[model samples]
Target: MVATIHVPVLVREVLSMLVVRPNGNYLDATFGGGGHTRAILENISESARLLAIDRDPDAIERGKQLAAEDSRVEVVQASFDQIADVSRRNGFEQFDGILFDVGVSSDQLENGRRGFSFQKNGPLDMRMDPTDGKPASEWLNTASVQSIATVLRKFGDERNARLIANAIVRARPLSETQELVELIDRVCKTQEVNKHVATRTFQAIRIHVNDELTQLRQGLRNAFELIGHAGRIAVITFHSLEHRTVRRQFSQWVDSSIPARMPIRGPNKGPMKIVERGLAPKRQETERNPRARSAMLQVVERVQ
Candidate 1:
């Protein structure tokens, strides 16, 4: 078996904010490698309970191993978007703290078979839940040119989305990772650069394949609803769009009143509030884990 490469980002900040109560109930929305979950458990007492969710099968297996000796830990193999359902089924109406480490795990990027990284040669598969979401190869092979362009543009902020989409369409049946990368390289005119030109294209496809933004939005709302008053919810986002979405949603939830559209509509007694401003990892954390460089952590609380 290939070794997994998952290094938790913003570990200290997450532990500091999410594990205040040793016996408190907590939720880890994205249990990538169980790194954050393990850290939280270490900081808590025996009575503390942790409920974690992961969409990846491999990650679920890893979580199983992590929970082998800890009966307090319950690992669920499901998307965090269904947090409300999962929590209720597990007999938890509310939690003391909730944490979300959004975006792909480092392990996913390192695993070439997953086709998440353009740097490696593999198939064009990039489904977080291979059992459900469409693969990148399938989307690229079947999607309309305009739709492809739109996804790349919206999700990756790719400027040459149209050209790239056309090129991808013209070069159909891109089954392998190299074929897609080479084609994108030709279209984006970044072949000379060391970085792969298909990076953004792949990211866009993955985002579309998994409905990541929507899941993130729903997961945030669920966290706000399922966490008790004064309970803190911390989210670590990797990209600008994801970070912006979390920040905006958290700000709305923490200021004035909860949005009407949010499913977790509490009474009009006034809005829940953020305990403090967003927190970024220390320079030392970035130095230790370069992946932490782009991590932005936003924390909110239910003031009511």
Candidate 2:
């Protein structure tokens, strides 16, 4: 099998924001294709340890190979929401830095068997970890029309979510990628320029199947708990939903206000400090990689 080429988005920005220390430990929370993990290892000192985590078994296997080549690297098979537990089990009480490259991996999308892409006719399985959780087809086939429409509207921002959901409900038991794609296309007659008509529906179903938003919210909380004082947290989000979650989390961490009902309160000091506002990929990088066009980077440092 030919190796999937995954160019890590915003490499330069991620590295610069991370501020790698020679002897500091780091965590690559989403070790998709091991692009960010590899870069971290290359830049950090040999004495510094880097733990890479991923939900996909295939990615974990690939990460194991990378770990084999370097004694300083350790790969774990787990979601980012399990970061605190995974880190503690791995002998890391706290990390000097953590990186989250949120969203689907290129390997999952390019490979039809993974079922993350509507461009390919494959099984409608969109699970990050194929071993667990119900597949997208199961959810779509069994979920209520209202539930399906809600997912489409909330996650995908689809304007014709009801129409699409109604069409899907009328045609139950969708098992293939193209079947759902065709159904959405028939119901939603208009298409965005340079984008597929089924893009939003596909995104909505995948998000619902994987529970991505919940995972993201939990992962951010776990990351904040595990990062040491002065340590940095860098997140690269590809969509508005992901970005908004990160933004809100950072804002809460940086807010100095305490609820009036709280009995015990420390000095009005926030636990985190914002490092930068929303940063986008440069024109050159976007031109080279169209996927980078929608990418946004956010950074924060734990102050307490």
Candidate 3:
């Protein structure tokens, strides 16, 4: 028997920000479970077009099934970081709107084969682009202990990162999810055992393997460039790290400054402006979809 899948964190909020011209062009950067994509297509005019992108091949395939009947929706297999290239190649020269539902999907977490969950034991592989990227297992085996600890501390904010890193290093060449979980459990002194200590470690590893934070930075920048005048960009970030990146990037876009200077270029002066402060899901939507509980939606529009 198949279980039901919950739609992602801020569907309604995203729709409110996007879906500008029913006939306008839109892009779904994450395309996880096609929840937002289906809604956008259903509500928009027949002429409205959607370009959905996902690095995970499984997500791309799933989106294909959801969009099979909608000729207006184009599904592409690629990371959201490649937003500019994908949009250009697909002839979406400039978009009316773009939505980024960042981070992992429920499909990946629940599906043990993807190795994203602690509920079901699986391999430690967490590459979103499994075709071209290195898996989490390979990284753990090869990374220095200090590097591991830094990722755990920076990404996961795991308090015992040093100890966890030491434990992981001692257990060299760890293969499965359970092995890492067990190693973390062993090193942790607390007996409460409320949840797996490896949860944060796993999250850190997944973020590193998938290059999620970096992709988000680039994707947002590309999005700012790709949106047409008055076009909107909606981002739904699940966790604190993802939220922080979105917040910082959007904040920079709002104030007309770059958060971090890059050698390639300095801040671009533009007419982009934050239309409003961030919004959260409604009480009803949150109740209906538990995953929506943590979602924070922020919108920005290109102003002339």
Candidate 4:
């Protein structure tokens, strides 16, 4: 079967805000489909070096292929949160541009065995790095009702979090995505219209299984440290939770609200400035890629 390739969203905006540099070091923290990486390469010079990192083995292999084709690219198999170590380990102590495309890819959703899509009947495994961490099924089947409910509420904002959690506990050992989807449908007592009732639950489970939010938060801090003066950090978030995290972090990094006070370190990390508060895909781009509909880009640059 031909796998669906994930088209990068807001390509023009990302390139504009990020690759304003004239041949400088760039990093793609989540090289999902290599679309953004390719776009960056096209905009950069022959002397410029770009590093792409991904936790997914499939993406890493694709990155390796791209690296082979282009000597300017270096592909690494690591989580985005490990940006600091990964960067220094590969001789990239600082960067002119950094991108964090946060969320799952179309390829993962289309592949049933990856267990990220509610429509697919794959095993309930949602770890971005399948080799590491426990599967979603293992957590869902074993976690307490309160724990499950908390994750649903915190990550997915599922209104019926407690109700769904209770139902899941009653129907123990959900091994398949369809099984969980059916359970959520029965509990919600509704059918899919604009969006599936199981969508939020699946997202919550996936996020919890992968510790995504924590990874993103840490990745943001690491990116802030790794970015050079005037270097831009652009983040494309797919969910409201991720949007909030990026916005709050960027705001704190800028700290525009803080009064004139001592230079003691608090939430305000110096040398960062906000470039783009919130940028969404244009109508034409959204039409071509529906996944870009919910995407929001936030950019911040370091200014010494």
For this target, which candidate reaches the highest TM-score against the unseen true structure? Answer: 2
Q: Which pairs of residues collide in candidate 2? A: none
Positional deviation of residue 261's Cα in model 1 after best superposition, in angstroms: 27
**Backbone collision count in every prediction?**
0, 0, 0, 0
Cα RMSDs, all models: 4.2, 4.3, 5.1, 3.9
Q: Where does candidate 4 stray beyond 4 Å?
A: 1-4, 191-193, 257-269
- How well is each residue in 139-170 modelled by candidate 2, as lDDT tens digits? 98999989999999999999999999999899
**Whole-model lDDT values for every prediction:** 0.83, 0.87, 0.81, 0.88
* TM per prediction: 0.92, 0.94, 0.90, 0.93
Error of 2 at 42 (Å): 1.1
lDDT score for residue 80 of model 4: 67
Instruction: Report lDDT (Cα) of residue 255, candidate 1.
Output: 44
The parts of candidate 3 lying over 4 Å away from their true place are: 1-4, 191-195, 256-270
lDDT of 1: 0.83
Extract clashing residue pairs from model 3.
none
Candidate 1 structure quality by residue, lDDT tens digits, 128-182: 8888967889989998999999999999888889999999899998888888888
What is the full ranking by TM-score, best candidate first?
A: 2, 4, 1, 3
Give the Cα error of residue 64 in candidate 2, in Å.
Answer: 0.6
